[model samples]
Target: MSGHSHWANIQHKKGAADNKRGKVFSKLARYIMIAAKNGGGDPAMNLPLRYAIEKARSVSMPKDNIERAVKKGCGENGGVTFDEIAYEGFGPGGSAIFVDILTDNRSRTNGEVRKIFEKGGGNMGGPGCTAHMFDRKGLLQVPALAVDEDALMELALEAGADDVERLGDLFEIRCDPTAFQAVRDALAKANLSTTMAEMTRLPKDPMDVDAEMGRKIIRLLEALDDHDDVQSVYTNAKVTEEMMGS
Candidate 1:
C-alpha cells in the first residue's frame, strides 16, 4: 500500500478530468454491465452490482444509462456481450503492468493493447506473468475531512478492516475481499462517506525508477488507460510528483 494510495489519488484527480469527456460514464457502464451479467440484475442480491452502481452514482452517471446497462447485461435489451480479460506486461524499468479489459471482441482488443505496449516501450506477456506480483483486496478511500483519524481507525478495525492509513488528504482503508461489503456497510451506518471504493489488485512491492524511466512508464500507462477497451490499468511503478514533473 506504500505507493498504491498515492497512485489511487492521482487516478481520482485524473478521472475527474476524464469524466468531462464522457470516458468515465463509458467505463462505469461497462462495470455495471459486467456486474449484472455475472450476478443477475438485482443489485440488492448482487454485491458486485451494488458496488458498481454505487461507483456509477458517485460520478453522476445517468440513471437511464445505468438501467440500460443492466438491461443489456440481463439480455432484456440486445447489446454486445462483453468478456473480461486481464493482460500482463512490463513497462519501463521492469515495472509490472496489469490491464483489466472488458471487450466484445477479444482479438481486436488484444491487438490494440499489444500495439500500445509495443509503442510505449513495453511488451505484453503471457497471462500470469505479472499477475503473480499483485494481491487482490478491497480498498476504500475516505476523505480526511470526513472523520477523526483515531475514530476512523477504531471503526475500521472493529469492522474487520485489514489496515487503515492516511494517503495525503485521504484515509485509505484496506480489507479482505470477503469483508469489503461489511466494512462499507459499517461506514455507511456511521454516516461516513468514501471518496473511492473498489476491489483492486495491490502490488506487493512497487518498483522505483529514475525520473526519465518513470516518465516513460507513466506515458505508457496513460496510453493504455485511454484505450476504450481498457477498464483499469495497474502498475508497480513508484513515481513521485517530482519525477512526473521532471
Candidate 2:
C-alpha cells in the first residue's frame, strides 16, 4: 500500500474514524458550505458542491445537516465565512508535505499550523514549493474479494480509469480528476461496491525513508491531521511495511 493509504487503513483499524465521526461530519459540512458558497447552492450546476455532497453521503452524514450547510452557504442562515488555504512544508528526511485548510481566521490557522510543523521537526515553505510535486487524482479502493481482477480492470479502463492496481487485499482504481464522477458512476452501474472513494493528491515521486524517519513523518502527518482546520495532508514520504510494523 502507499504510505497515505496504509496510514488511512491503520486509522480505520484503530477505530479513529468512528471515534472522530463527529469531527469528520463537521469537516464535510465545511467542505460542502465552501463549495456551495463558491459555486452556488445548486449541486447540479456546481461540480464542487456535487462532489462534496456525494462524499458526505458516502460517509452517511445526515441529510438534514447537508441541506442546512447548503442553505448556510447560500446565505439563508447567515453562515460563517471561510477561506480555503494551502500550506507547504518539509517533514523528516526532507520529504515534501502539503496541507489543505479551511478556516475563518487565516492568521490563527497559520500560527497554529506553523507551530505544528516546528513541533514536528519540520519547517514551512512558501506556497507552490510542495504543491508541484503532486497530482490530483480520483482514487477508488475496492476489496479484492468483492470483484474479479480481470473483470474490474476491463470495466474500469473502459469506464475512463487510468489504471487498476492490485494492492494487497484491495484493488485501487485511479483516474483523472475530470473523469472521477464518470468512473464512479460506471462502477456503480456495473454493481461494484467500493470500500473507499475520493479525489486526493498523489505524490508524483514518493521519497523512501528509514524506519526512524518514517515514524517521525507519521507523527507530523498525524498531528496535522488532528487539527480541526486541516482538511487533508499529502506527503512524498513513503513508508515500508517493515517501517510500519516497527
Candidate 3:
C-alpha cells in the first residue's frame, strides 16, 4: 500500500493541475456518459453513475458538464455511441500496462494507441495479456490525521473491507467492489473523511524500475492518458519518490 499511496498522492496533485486546465474534463465526461448508458441516468439507482459523478466533481468538472453528459448518454442530445475497451500491454522495464478507452471508432483508437505505445518504447499485447495480473477492487484513501490506525482498521474490517495498510500519511482500505458503498457509508457514518474512493484495477505484483525507466514509463502513461479516447491508464510500475522527483 506504500506504493499505492505514493502513486495516489502523485495522481491527486497531478489531477488538481489537470482540472484547472480542463484537461480531465473530457475524460470525466466520457466516464459519466458511459456510466449513464450502462446503468441509466438516475444516480440513485445507478451506483456506477454515482461514482462517476463523484469522480467528476472531485476534479472540479462543472455541474452543467456533468448533467449534459448524463443527458447525452440517456439519448436526450443524440450523443455518439461509445464502446468501452481495455488495452493491455507491456511498457518499458516489462511494466504491465492497462489502458481503458471509450470511443465510437475502434480502428482509429487502435491505431492511435499503437502509435503511442511504439513511440513510448512499449508494445500493445493481446487482450488479457496483462489484465490477468490485476484485480478489480475498491480503494479508499483516508488522511492519517483523520483517525487512529487501530480504530480505523476495526471499522473498515467490520464494514467488510478486505485489508487496510498504512501508507505514509494515509490509510489505504481495500474492499470488494460490491461492498464499496457499504464500507464508504460506514466510514462516513463514523465521520471519517476520504481523500479518494474508486473501484480500480490493482496490480498483483509490481515491477521496480530504475529512475530512467520509471520516467519513460510515466511518460508513456501520461501520453496514453492525454489521448481523447483514453479514459484511464493503469500500470504495475513501482515508481519511487526519487524517480518522480527526478
Best by lDDT: 1
Cα lDDT tens digits for candidate 1, 1-246: 567644555666677789899998998899899999999999999989998998888888889999999988887778548999999999877889999999989999999999999999999999899999887889998899989999999999998999999887889999889989889999999999888888887788877787899888888888998999888888877876665544
TM-score of each: 0.95, 0.91, 0.95
Which ranges of candidate 2 are over 4 A from the true structure? 1-21, 240-246
Total clashes for model 2: 0
Candidates by TM-score, descending order: 1, 3, 2
- Candidate 3: Cα lDDT at 128: 90
Error of 3 at 78 (Å): 1.7
lDDT (CA) for every model shown? 0.86, 0.84, 0.86
Candidate 2 per-residue C-alpha lDDT over 91-203 given as tens digits, one digit per residue, 9 for 90 to 100: 88798999999999999999999999999999899999999998898888888998899999998998899889888989988899988988899889988888777878888
Q: Against the true structure, candidate 2 has what lDDT?
A: 0.84
Q: By lDDT, highest first, what's the ranking?
A: 1, 3, 2
Model 3, span 133-188: residue lDDT tens: 87788999899999999999999999999999988788899999988999999999
Return whichever of 2 and 3 wins on TM-score.
3
Instruction: Report the error of model 3 at residue 144, Å.
Output: 0.5
Which residue pairs in candidate 1 have backbone atoms (N, alpha carbon, C) closer than 3 angstroms, thus clashing?
A: none
